[model samples]
Structure formats: C-alpha cells, structure tokens
Target: MKRAVIYYSLTGNTMKTAELVAERCGADLIRIDMVKPMPEGFKKQIMYGGMLATFGKKPEITGIPDNITAYDDIILGTPVWASTFAPALRTLFTKKDIGDKVSAVFTLSGSGDNTKCLKKLSKFCPNIKNSVSLSDENNGKPQDNKGLLEDFIKKISY
Candidate 1:
C-alpha cells in the first residue's frame, strides 16, 4: 500500500521524525508550510506561534496536497506546542478532509508530554490507528527516540 507522511514542523524535530518515518515506511513527504513563516528563536516563536496554536488559528498554508486519496495509509506528524498542535495543522485540516482517515500519528514534544496535544489532535484526524509520542532529547534530535520510533514504525508498517 502507498503511504504519505504529512507533517508540520517549527524547530525541525517533527520534520526529522517525518523523514525517518517516510524512509522506513517508504512514504511520500508532504509538508505543511505557512504562507508567512513563523519567526526564529524560542521567545519569538513562543510568544507569536504559541499564541496562534493556543487560539486554534488556522493560518494560510502552502505545499500540501489538496486530495488525500493517493495514499492508502497516512502518517500524521506534528510538533507539540502550548499543549496543542501547531496552527499549520488547523490550516491543513481545513484544506484537506481527513476526518475519515484512520491514520498513524506521532508528535515531538519538548517535555515528552504530548497527551494534551494528542487529545486535541484527534478532533482533526479522529480515526488514529496508532501513535507515538517522542520527547525532546539531544537538543531536539529525533535520534533519542530510536526505540520508540522503531516500535511505531513496526506497528504502522504494512
């Protein structure tokens, strides 16, 4: 079956995870990019990006596929922010109808606590078949979650 790893990343952690998943699953990579990119640095990102995520702001996104039928399995990927998903996902949901898709999911959280964000994420992509939460380690490097990543890939592997 064909697969697609659709994701949004701010600090590149989620992107890194997406890459690994795509490579392992042999899936296509579709990025969620904001029309006006978020600012760099923690303070600015927290103040501006956090606020948008907190408020569930659906900003304009680019580079995502409008249709979801190309892939039989989809892996949803994102970075946890303010106990919720980044605003780009909100925009992605608006642009693509994925409510009926039973997706495999993953999240990259700084504190390694993504329960809140995953709870909120289910509202967009409700039919999750499997999920993995990875904590920030090695300076937001995904390599630290090697074991968990391998397990997740196994469950979602076809």
Candidate 2:
C-alpha cells in the first residue's frame, strides 16, 4: 500500500521516529509544522505546549501535504504533551477531512502514558487502524524501538 508518514516534531524526536517509519514502510514522508515555533527551553516548552494541548487550542500550521486522501494509508506521529497529542495536530484535524482514510498513530512520549493521547487521536480520526506508544527517554532520540515501530507498520500497512 502507498502510505504517508505525516508528523510534527518540535525537537526532532517525532521527526526521528517518522523517518524510521517512512523508511521501514517505504512510505512518503511529510512534516507539518506549527505556524509559531514553540519555545526552545525544555520545561517552558512543555509547560506551554501542554497547556495549549490541554485546552484544545489549535495552533496554526504549515507544510500540510496535498491530497492526503490519495494515499492508501496514513501514519500520523506526534509528541505527547500532558498525556495528549500536541496542539498542532488540532490544526491538522480542523483543516483536513481524513475521516475515510486508513490511519494509524505513533507517539513519542517520556512518561509512557500515550494511550490517552492515542485514544484522543482515534476519536479525531475514527478510522485509526492501530496505535503505538514509544518511550523517548533520550529527548526524541529513540533507541531500541525498532521492534515496536515495525509492529505498528505491519498492523496498518496491509
């Protein structure tokens, strides 16, 4: 199947995971970004970003891939904030009609409670075929997660 690995990465964690997914699935890779860059400091960025996410605020975004429906499958990736997906994805969900597409989610998280985020994402994209939560202990430089990533790819690729 033709798949698109779409993601947002504030500090390269999601980007690294997206790269691995795209390479493993031989899928087209796309990155959507927040219109306003989040703060660079780790604590401040998390605090602010988590607040925005918690409040269901939709920040503006750019680099949205054209004709996302053209693909057979979509693999969405985001970093976890306050046990939820980033607010930037709120913008994507608002701007796009992805209801009918085959989708899966992969989240890079520190606390390992990405199930909440995954459930939230599934609510937004009802057709989500599978979900994977990965621990990013190295600040987005994930290690020893190839098995988990591959399993997620297999679940949705067919």
Candidate 3:
C-alpha cells in the first residue's frame, strides 16, 4: 500500500515513534511544524502548549505535505497534550480532506489515557483503520512499543 505518516512532535518522543512506524511500513514520513513553535522549557511547554490543547486551540501550521490523495493510507501521529491529540492536528484537518482515505491515528503519551484522543481523531478521519498509543517514561522518551506498532501496521496494510 502507498502510505504516509503525517505527524507533529514537540519533544521528540512522537518523532521517534513516527520514524519506526514509517520504516516498518515503508511509508513516506512527513513532519508537521507549527508556524510558531512551542516554548522549549518544560514549564513553558506545560503552561503554553498544554493550555492550547486544554482549550482545543488549533494553532496555525505549515509544511503540510501536498498530494496526500496519492497515498492509499494516512497515519496521523501526535504527542498527547492535555490527554488528547495536539491542537496542530485540527489545523491540518482543516487544510486537507481524508474522507476517502484509509487512515489510522497513533499517540505518544506520558502515562496519560488516549480515550479522548482517539475520539478526537475520529472526527477528522472517520474511517480510521487502527489506533495505537505508546507511553513515554516520564523522562520524555518513548518506551519500546514495537509490538503495538507492528500490530497497527498489520491492521492498515494490505
């Protein structure tokens, strides 16, 4: 299948997961960046970034890959914020259409539940074929979740 992994990562955890998933699936990996990037300090990340997520603010984004319609499947990757997918996803969704595509959503969290996150993803990609959540070890590093990622690959792949 022609697949693409579109993702946003603030602290590298989600980026790592995205890389592994893309390599395993032989999918194009595209990273989404907010026009105004978040603060770098830990406290600021929580204060500013978390606040945006908490309020469901979809900040402006740039570098959205073009020609996504050419891919058969789209994998949306995000880092958990306020227990849900990051707000940047909203901006992306507003810019593109995934209605006729087979898609999946994956998240990297710091021991936070992804129930709400998955629900939000469905609003954008109703036909989401699978969802995966990988927890980070508080130190901001993603825990090993190769098995979970592989299963997601199987669910989305032909």
Per-candidate TM-scores read 0.91, 0.88, 0.87
Q: Report the CA-based lDDT of candidate 1 relative to the real structure.
A: 0.84
**What's the ranking of the predictions by lDDT, best on top?**
1, 2, 3
Error of 3 at 135 (Å): 0.3
Residue-wise C-alpha lDDT for candidate 3, range 83-105, written one tens digit per residue: 77788877777777753463787
For model 1, how does the per-residue alpha-carbon lDDT over 70-143 read when each residue is reduced to its tens digit?
66778888888899987988887787776456488899887877889888988877888799889887655545
**lDDT of each structure?**
0.84, 0.81, 0.80
**Tens-digit per-residue lDDT, 1-158, candidate 2:** 66788888888889998998888778899898888888879889978898898999999899887777678778888999888888887788788876446377888888655878877777788888688888776645535576877778787654
Off by over 4 Å in 1: 139-144
Cα RMSDs, all models: 2.3, 2.6, 2.5
Clashing pairs in 1: none
Query: Candidate 3, 11: how far from true, in Å?
Result: 0.9
Which of 1 and 3 is ahead in TM-score? Answer: 1
